[model samples]
Target: MTTYAIAHLHQTELCAEIVEYLEKIDGTLAPFGGRFIIHGGRVEQLEGKFRGNLIVIEFDDRERARTWYRSPAYQAILPLRTRHASGDVFFIDQVAQPHRATDILEGIRVPTAGVAP
Candidate 1:
């Protein structure tokens, strides 16, 4: 399954360090087949308030995503971004194709009133 590394970065500083991070990040991602699907583009806010930039990088699978994140090349440059930005970063698996909105319910277990969950 495809997986994504998503980040919502706020209060980012456009400093020399950040510039360097941007220049070098591509090299780190190439070996892992990770590419940016979204990178700080203009957002159309339809509902709740949103702050800062949203970044999404796609990977072949969860394991590849995990490995890319943990790789030394990526780790080495992580501090460059971390020192200049404040945000949330996480990995999420893509949903299967030909799916329904209710498909997720199958993996969720609701406890019966008399049973311990």
Candidate 2:
């Protein structure tokens, strides 16, 4: 399954760090077929309030996302994301077909009621 990553920054030196990272550490994701779908750009606030920047990335699967994050290349950029940005970072598995009903169920692991459900 495909996976997506969302990053929202409130007060990060995220831009500068991202530039540095792209220049040097982006190679790690090459093998994983990682791609940038959304970046820090213009956004229209039609709902909730937010500040700083927003980023969204797509990867082939969870493993690639995990690998890219831990890989040396990405790790090299980690400090920038850490020192600069601070908002929300999350990963989600994509659904082949978009459906509101299924969307609600995604990632909702209904644990056995008896043992830590």
Candidate 3:
């Protein structure tokens, strides 16, 4: 299954370190087949407030995504972005096709009758 590395970066500093990080990040991702699906483009907000930039990188699978994140190349430059930006970063697996909105309910362990959840 495809996996994504998503980040919501706020209060980013456009400094020399950040510029260097941007230049070198692609090289780190290439070996892992990771590519940017979204790179902080303009937003067309239709709901609640949003600020800062959103970045999404796609990987072939969860293993590849995890390996890339832990690889020395990515780890080397990790501090560059961390030092200049504040935000959230996480990995998420893509849902399978022919899916329903409630498919996630299957993973929930519903409380048994008369038992506390």
lDDT of each: 0.95, 0.78, 0.96
The top-ranked prediction according to lDDT is 3
Q: Of 1 and 2, which scores higher on lDDT?
A: 1
- Kindly provide the TM-score of model 2 when superposed on the true structure, using C-alpha atoms: 0.75
User: Between 2 and 3, whose lDDT is larger?
Assistant: 3
Where is the poorest 10-residue window by lDDT in model 1?
102-111
Candidate 2 vs candidate 3: the TM-score winner is 3
Cα lDDT tens digits, model 2, 51-110, are 888888899898888888888777777786677667888888887675576567767886
lDDT of 1: 0.95
TM-score of each: 0.89, 0.75, 0.89
In model 3, the worst 10-residue window by lDDT is 102-111
Instruction: Score residue 15 of candidate 3 by CA lDDT.
Output: 98
lDDT of 3 by residue, 1-117 (tens): 999999999779999999999999999999999999999999999999999999999999999999999999999999999999999999999999989998988979878999887
What's the best-to-worst order under lDDT? 3, 1, 2
